[model samples]
Target: MVFQCQRDSWARQFTTQVVSCCPAELQTEVSGKKATLQGFHVILEDTILFPEGGGQPDDRGFISDIPVLRVTRQGPDALHFVQKPLEPGSEVQLTVDWDRRFDHMQHETQLFIPGQHLITAIADQMFGFKTTSWELGRQRSTIELDTPTMTAEQVVALEQSVNKKIQERIPVVVTEFSAGDPEAETVRSRGLPDDHTGPIRTINIEGIDANMCCGTHVSNLSDLQVIKLLGTEKGKKNKTNLIFLAGNRVLKTLERCHGTEKALTSLLKCGAEEHVEAVKRLQNSMKLLHKNNLSLLRDLAVMTAQSFKSNQPFPPHRKDGDSEFMNIIANEIGTEETLMFLSTGDEKAAGLFLLAGPSAMVETMGPRVAELLEGKGAGKRDRYQGKATRMSKRAEVQALLREFTSHQSTEE
Candidate 1:
């Protein structure tokens, strides 16, 4: 079904009569103005909202105090989706989210003016690149160059030229061209639709370029304010996607970069300009510290092994003088296979490593210790390693090792 079209320009709010209200089809993901169709919708006789079209997003605001989720075109009518549907034939307020609309407008203008002109001046007209397509968004815009890659100098030159044009403050002019007009040959787009008749909208940036477009545009070049080329990347079919930021987005990018600089400066304990050097120094210091720590742990392991060789109690464990306390050490001590556990936070719980010297001892004792400690591990030749939850079973571990050693001595 087609709805009658009404003539309206860019506006923020309006008092419009509701034409119809209906339930959204169940789970039908349809998009009219390129925006997802969602929720219940109401069609208004006249609306201030711009239906998502011409590569710009739909307006967001309230209709009779019910916040519209999204606005999209259904034939010639603008369908406003909302949680609460309005009654047909009722008068309601239609408003646009000014900030969001402005953002989309700026994005659209960027592509129409500086974005298109820059690519034409650089890739094709000058450097011989066949143009493909371009896309614009809230945060960034990407223009595809015909070939997959561009030279570093070309990218730099393109960015510089575009920014220069934006700063020139060239006037933007929008005009209508009648069908079969001589100027129609100048259109960058392939001729208008077959059904297209009457006058076509043409946007002209004074002395820069002109193209047929139906999107909202800025009246002046100064409205764009700033244009920043972020970088270039490979896109579909070896096309070079040049990314950039325009208008308020440039300022937003600066804000985020400043925040990142401040964080880096504070984390590295250095001035903003010296953050890189400070980070390097920190990395070097960490490497040195790691080396020293490993040396200490190795020395401790050897000393701990010596204590086991002698009749000494294990480190970090209670040695009751009244009883014959035993030392159960796991380390490379004169070929005696034992599981060497590295200490973590809790000395009473599982240590870091469950290392042993011999495959037989580790294979037999690994699962036994794991079962007693309610943990698990794997055994290799001459070594077994894993964590144990039965950390408090230090005495049990010591008794098991002692019994194994006694039996070994008898067998020998």
Candidate 2:
């Protein structure tokens, strides 16, 4: 179960014989779409590829030119999933992606070992805060401390303390002990898995801390480059999550933030430092403009309604408005005697309609007009309103309303 990867984390290439290869399927994403990948599960006699475990992702590499999509541990064997299969007992060259492996090592060091230890020590010693739990993410990580909140000043001090340790370049040593060894109790452990049957491994950071871990890690504190505390967020119960980035992640995050600042400067037409104030001013102006526009629209609605004759059937349509505006016009015109059909929207797209008049006439014509406009609506008393998708059929609806009103007057 102890693979070559765990024995020699620096190894990049290895030659091994394939033990078994079987047809398998991997669920993966391609071009932002979920898809099932048809592949083969290959087990090699020995491997340099680290399987996904201990909060670290699997290594990406090639097995004799065949791309390894994923590597996972099944029981005691590391399974390499690939598109093509190799014959059992065939010798193959396993090549690890060094850049990706190093990045993962840096992340694992900060997320699982050194970072957690540093935070726990400083928080408990300096602030009397206890770490409850932690989580590892691909780009960033967080350690939850048993505190309701962490002050900005405390965060700055914590970050400084962590980076100071990194500058010291403390050596990180990995030591293994037999399962029943008494020395194993000295290393901080959260108990082992029930199925575990190997020597216990502990990572020691010079005189700072020692904790049991199975993840790949950097050899020294200096390899982490720097630890950037990205503030904190509320966690479950009375806990606070301190989010952070380490090593190359810190540099990448700075680059992305600088790019965003440059874009904001150009868009706001101001210096980077003044971008926040500039955006606030623009938002205030927008609010005032919106208020004025609504007043003008209501004024227009009243004028249009007042221009209609009282005894005649009124059917008015607008290409640039909504259901609320149509209802405004219907309310101003008084829909008791005169049958009214009001609509507002683009001819090529969806719109809104309002039919208001006598209760009997509105109930009778509401469904017919809604059907013709390819919409659904319900009414109470004399008002019927709903959204319509076929605003282009406005002319047909107008004709239907005119004929109905004319026939009613003749019958009366």
Candidate 3:
């Protein structure tokens, strides 16, 4: 069944009777979070809302006072999912979301038609690249050309050629033919779907290109406003995906870029042109400062180790440091017979721990300390190290080390 939307893309409202209504669920996003919408899949006798197909999203609108969440095509039927169910035989008014519909038309017709046509033509004629595939994304679209790589000069040329065609204001013509008609073979298409039984529709960009498509389109190339090629990305084996924006999308992208430029200028305390240089200088300065800080920490570790009492259990705790710093102090002290437990970080939060002593004693006490500190660790020889969350239990760890060392000394 050809939907009223497919027949008249400009239609905003239609009077239709509900053919069937069944409980259904729609997965959608609210704010930035995923949500499941409980609704009724209502099939109307006829509708002005376009169902999701051909890389385009479904239309959002309302059936009477009930909000229509989504529309999807089930074979020949256009199913309208709504929050509230209408009686199967009841008559209802279907209203399309015009703003959203027009935006989609701009993206679909303006971008898809000219973008696909011009890119494919230019790549084939100039670079001998063949069109492999294309995707119509909500924000941007990509046309993959069968090429290993694309140069900057080639991208600029493609953008310029597309915009030039838009300026020409070429008339876009839509023609339909019966499925089995010999005239259908004259149109350029990948191929008709196996289940495609409707009349074959083709969009002709007056004297430029012709291709079979089922989605709605603009009547003229001028409606596209402008095309912006956002450069190209490496796609699957031997393919280059050329990404682009058209119509209002180009304007929106420029607006976002300008806003970002202003924000960067203010944060960097520099003009827009100098933002890159300023950020580079700032990064270099940070690297130097970080290098100096590490040197000072190593020096402090050496001094603390020199004051260590020999042949005793020493538990050194600090406010802020890391595993490397703890290891530095242990290395300086020389853990031959001295049992040392080194920890650094906030008492209220998380920290690092290093236990060093005789291999036998370290193996025995490592598990005990790890369990108390609420952390796991492994060690070989005479050292054990890992991260711990319960740094607040420092006092308990100190006691455990002290008792174990004292008992060993008594037996010795």
Candidate 4:
């Protein structure tokens, strides 16, 4: 059987206080040219305030006595949702959060740095510039110059030019324009959408940067404080990637770097400048010591091989340092008649067996011997190596080898 559950539609409704208002106050609903706070409603005659849109944050400010919490956009209407809802049709003075708005505006206006640009005929009327993205992370910003692409040298030159403009403290002028108007031509030529119903806001910094945008901005370039171009990378074929930091964020990053350097110096027991050299020296010494140890084991294996008796297999045993010694002995024998078996007795025992016998003997019985011992082993041509988690007794290894040789002789 299937069961269905009903969903409540109005379960998420909330009532909030309208604290602050935005400049979009012009479209606010009002009665008799007076702002009233009757019901939870706000009415305004006209407003120049901007709303949050296109990745830009909403303006923050206080309205009357209440602070503006957030700015929401509904259709073409920018709704300034306040902390506390005000009465409808009540006459009241409105204020905007200018500091936050100005910061957003400054960030958006700084997009037009001089550089190489490209114009692409994407579709019928849709054209996007293949340009460099200068503003990254916090705000992904890009600038499309008149040129298609800039060379590596050209990019360096453009970077210097943009930073110079930021330092010059050029004033950022914000103006509005309508379609068919002369000012609107600037917007049209740049391939930006024209707003004929109302004035289109344009941000221009004297001969340096100009673009149409609705985000809040700073009044002057000096307010930017500092501009830092971090790094650049290749984006699309004709486009480049640019990373940058501005004002307060850059200062904070500098402070973090200094702190990290101090910690590293204390841990490494060396000055910051000498830390890298000290690490390299230590690594080189360790490598040399490892080579010398391997050489000594190779010499010991030669002496051990000479002690083996003819026609008898050696039982494997693991001592504190048997693993390296066994491998060395296996290498020294390098014969087709001798088999080496070694093991060690510890809390957790282990064993290693190496076989170098008649090719026929190993081929027929190697797999069976490995299986009976409850271990894993493999053979190639006339040789085999087996490893056991628990060491095998000396008699067990000898019996397996004897049976293997006898089975091969019988088959022949």
Candidate 5:
């Protein structure tokens, strides 16, 4: 069934022909100064977007300038949210952001939890602890244990036993066959559907853990860099979350920490070990200096206000470029009014602003002021600040402020 989009601005309705062009139709919403966009919700007749199912993350993508934050399947439909508005009925192309998707796919494919390890360990202990459980987590495989509790001593012993196997460079083979005997050469792992019939897949890490699994895995045990056991905690009744990292990732993380330490030491002009203390001392000193500066600025503002009131031959000097002094005065006074403050210096860009005040100036004409400025900003009833990037003429800002004040009075 094909549906055409129609516009009803009152209904906040916008239409596009994206549904016919691609398998997915995307929607977007944009707002504010930083222009932080969030939305690219795809509504497709049918889609490839996977639901948050089986401990896997959703996909992300983009359309035009809009970034798709998340893609999820609702029943039979897929919804995509974007950062900005897209034209209705326009055939816009869509692309899935693959970096995130690939990482998620890799994680899903390599969930190497420790069900088989625990079971085999139990069997081995009963039969004289002859078999070994390799450190599967070291190879980029996420491993979990099903047992409720294991002591620190036991974990250390297990790790030692597993690493010994890695030094042996064992073969990890995957195969499929009919399920029959319990004491066969292979065993069934988890992740199989409930309604299974014949060809069950089995993973055999020779002289180590062997179980059935349908997930993707690397061929050799040596491909795993090194399984460094981070920590472990007891789970519901008889399960344990064995937290660890695999292979080159752990090494990379350690290297990153070392690099950060060196960079921070150089930045702080201190030795690596003294960096933290130096930073803390510098922070304390800066805070004290800032307080002193603020006190001086407040005294100057009071004196300046008095001069303005008394007409003490103080010329309205154009301050530094970007009018940092004007901003300072606004912050200090904390007043909301249609106040016109100007700063002039040999600067390049004319940064024009339609600054709103705490009083009536912002309440009525803030939005209209922003629209006139050819820039975008929004604020509450008390205060607002918007800029005119293109308004290079110094007189234009004064003109807009005057126009806004005049229009505001007439509207009132």
Candidate 6:
């Protein structure tokens, strides 16, 4: 049946009789009464819900106070998916979600979201540049301009030009045409959809733009309040996505951005205007401090390694040739002559750096240490280095290394 939504974009209610409703699923209510509980498609004599179309979302609403989950187009009818079923031939009240409907209507304004319908359309008419595509967000919209060599200066110029037109507060005009009308085909913004036939709706923004469209829109450019271009992002096909804000969204974005700037200023200990430079300076200071600390750790490691050099035993070839052992510095914890266990990390986790006088000791104990950490270690030049997960087992690792060295000494 012909629907009110198709003709009157602002229709909010309908008192209709249910032609048919099939329950997609059934459930028992608290009164043990069977309830379809939504997911069922219902057909009414007529509806005010605009089904999903023209890249816009479907109308969400209530029928008989039950939620309308979704609305989709089927041939010539609008199908409303509802939570509960209504008896066929019964009368019901259908109400549209006015807030959502008006929000969509706000976005459809030529002054709010730039497209082939606003000053962008004028750009095409005046120059070779135009919007190739557009996207609408909750509080923002993006229109991809078709110029490949467009500059930042040019984008600013375009924004100023659009804003100038908006300040004029031009009235928007709607024109209709019969099927396959030559005038409808002449619209600059977009072509007809696949199934569009008969009457064609063309939107005109005074002398600026004229385009084929089905979405609802504002009556005047002034209702948009103002248009604020956020910036541009590189788009597909070398186009540029022009981000913008309008009306209530412009104020909302400004409020949100101010809050973010305040947070950054506090974190960097700087004024709002100086936040970026202050953050950069703080990061540089942190990098310098990290480099200095690493240098200190390396110097300490070298000193520790040198003390172990004299305590370790000489290779078999060196000992066989001379029959003497190198002397190691003695300490309460360990001396390198037999073994030295060095480690790093904190109470929760650590790593092991083991140096042994005899190669045999490193080969035998390294695997056991690795298993304890569920990790791997490698040995080279009498030093075994690897990460250990069981940091609290530092004493256990020392005991194992000691036991291995003692066994090798006994064999000798």
Give lDDT tens digits, candidate 6, residues 168-255.
Answer: 9888776778876777778764465566545777678887777666666667777667777777888888887778777777777889
Count of clashing residue pairs in every prediction: 9, 0, 0, 42, 25, 4
Instruction: Give one digit per residue, the lDDT tens place, for model 5 in 56-82.
Output: 455555554556666554443445655
TM-score of every candidate? 0.67, 0.86, 0.87, 0.47, 0.48, 0.67
**After superposition on all CA atoms, what RMSD does each candidate show versus the true structure?**
7.8, 3.2, 3.2, 14.9, 14.6, 9.8
Model 1: per-residue lDDT, tens digit, 41-99? 78887777777655567778899789987778756567887878678889887777877
Alpha-carbon lDDT of model 2: 0.84
**Tens digits of lDDT, candidate 4, 3-122:** 000011111122333333333333344565655232222323333334555445555554466655555555444455553666554454545555444445545545532221111111
Local lDDT at 279 for model 6: 79
CA error at residue 126 for candidate 4, angstroms: 27
Q: In candidate 3, which residue ranges exceed 4 Å CA deviation?
A: 27-37, 97-100, 110-118, 307-320, 407-412
- Best-fitting candidate, scored by lDDT: 2
State residue 304's C-alpha deviation in candidate 1, in Å: 5.2
Tell me model 1's lDDT, rounded to 2 decimals: 0.65
What is the Cα-based lDDT of residue 53 in candidate 1? 57
Q: What are the Cα lDDT values of the candidates?
A: 0.65, 0.84, 0.81, 0.51, 0.49, 0.66
* Colliding pairs, model 2: none
Model 1, backbone clash pairs (residues 3+ apart or across chains), number: 9
Q: What TM-score does model 4 achieve against the real structure?
A: 0.47
Regions more than 4 Å wrong, model 1: 1-10, 25-38, 112-123, 130-138, 174-186, 190-202, 212-214, 259-271, 298-412
